[model samples]
Target: MVSVLSPAEVKLPDGSSTDFANLDVAATAPCLDVVAEAVADLLPWYGSVHRGAGALAQRSTREYEQARETLYEHLGCGPGDAVVFTRNTTDALNLLAHVLPPGTTVVTFDVEHHANLLPWRTPVRIGTPRSPGEAVATLDEALRQVSGPVLVAVTAASNVTGELWPVRELAEVAHRHGARIAVDAAQLAPHAPVDMAALGADYVALSGHKVYAPFGAGVLAGRADWLDAAPPYLAGGGATAGVSADFAVRWHDGPARHEAGTPNLIGAVALATACRVLAGADLSAEAHLVARLRAGIARLPHVEELRLFDAAAPRVGIVSFAVLGRDPDELSTELGRDHAIGVRTGLFCAHPLTRRLLREAAGRLDPSAEPPGAAIRASLGIGTSEEHVDRLLAVLSAPLFGE
Candidate 1:
């Protein structure tokens, strides 16, 4: 089991303290105690990476590079692959977008998070499929029509619905039609194991904050050919190998090319530590907790669970829902103010999918004058327990603020 920090106490509106029940792990997870300890241990020796000659500098550089290798192996990447660190998953995907060869057509789904959806310049947007099989078939047909060097961008798991996507099958379909696939694994990596090479993915992006690291770091690991051929993602001192007096410069290849400025040594180390800890975690226990939470939610009458796929479909530790007569925003505020529960209530950065679910629930799309429809999401993680789930359900079932 992964050890996390103790439950934090929050001051309620009545000026009383209560143990905070965090249910917003989908946005950003709490840091692991092991990760925090790892970062604390390295602070004294933290110094310039790959530059200074001091003892601290040498140690820090070695630690930084070792973090890179640790993450590479954790993700099951091949020796030929290159892992480039970025600020977060958004930055990693944006870096990939900037490096695609000219005339390369990109294909993506409308149901994807905005981080994956908005990066490509002109992608052929596929509509949300009713089922995972339909998603694969749709992509197969789309890939057959594209001629040139094609790239397919997909999410390993739905950020809004928590439904798992058929990443391996999607990668196979993309490869059969001479296309490369990139996976946005920010939501998937925290709950389940993600292996880019094993999934046959050409590229994979994930965020550190979502995986119990809580550090501003992410990774884009994939084939080195396209990344090496493309210009440096950022041009600066570290990225360049030699600069001529005549205003000419030669850039370095591998991860350093994209990581131009001073890298986040601490963030990288924390993320790597998190990967190591989670790799050995018994995920079956986490799955059981998620099942218990889902079953409890299903027993509520007025609450309707939001899902693009069937309930039996494999999902991560997330469950989004809407009450029959209450605005999700108001309900979210009450949950935090009256009770000490923290949950996310919004489009969850997947506006297209959220709006579709809202329409399905209300039978009519909100007009332009009305506020945007939203849902309350209770996302679980390693830190979640049975008590947390029970408290949330109890509060939702009872009258809120004496309503």
Candidate 2:
């Protein structure tokens, strides 16, 4: 297993310390040992890239550019693709939105994280699907209604339910309708292999923090045509070849057109190193943990594990659930405050999907019961252990947790 930084122990409200079991890898994974080392190794020679004549600057430029190549290959970018680094998935998607053609219509699902949903200019939102097949069919139907230039943005895996989407099918549907597809892979890339060619994706965006390289770097990798033709994302020295006092500027094509000013050298290297480490590593261990966790949750009659598709569908080591008549905020707080465990609670940035699932689950359980506004999400990573899963299950077994 890849070595991750130790999350260490947490202190209880009574000032007692205990081992902290982190089950929130879906929110932000603990840093990898190799990612931290890469950052440390690059820090000593840190220098601004692009124009400096010093050896450090030249070396920095090489490292920064190499990071781009590493991400491009890791993401399965096409030969004509351009890899542009940004702050995170949100920034990356926003850059794409900025560069899109004037009359281009954007299509996305209501299930997206705010990162994917908010950046587009009046995106045509598709309704949530009951199954993977329904997703593709629904998207196809939605696309058929719209005309002109269209870009279909979809999530590779859902952040709320950990359910994997039908990216390849969606890609085929988009192409059949004369549209392009972009993948919001912020959640999927960390848990599974994302091959752009295999998925037939034209663009992909992902964040470093969620991939065990939390130094504030992200990637937007895809076709170069639109990006190359757009104006510079940021009008600054490195992005422009020539500038005049009257505000006229000549912008460089490719990645540099979007990545203006100074780049995050250490962050980029760390992200690239993490991408290399996690690329095709053993995922069965995480799957085993998921199986154990879900099975344990099933034993708790009051607990209802949230899912978007069939009960037997495969997930990426994440389990979101609701306990009868319990507020998720209070449950998550008590878990951390008293039991020294870490998990995420609330809508999880996928507001529409989360709320809809909660409502649907509520209606199934009892028509009189109100839908929960939030849910508890326990996500696993390479660093998560079987003991941690068992520990969480044990804690939840206590009948009067609120009392």
**Top-TM-score structure, candidate number:** 2
Kindly list the per-residue Cα lDDT of model 2 for residues 50-141, writing each as its tens digit: 87889899899999999999988888887899999999999999999999988899999888899989989969999878899999999999
Give model 2's clash tally: 0
Could you tell me the lDDT of residue 143 within candidate 2? 93
Q: lDDT value for candidate 1?
A: 0.88
User: Each candidate's TM vs. the true structure?
Assistant: 0.95, 0.96
Cα displacement (Å) at residue 128, model 1: 0.9
Against the true structure, candidate 1 reaches a TM-score of 0.95
**Lowest summed lDDT over 10 consecutive residues: which window, candidate 1?**
363-372
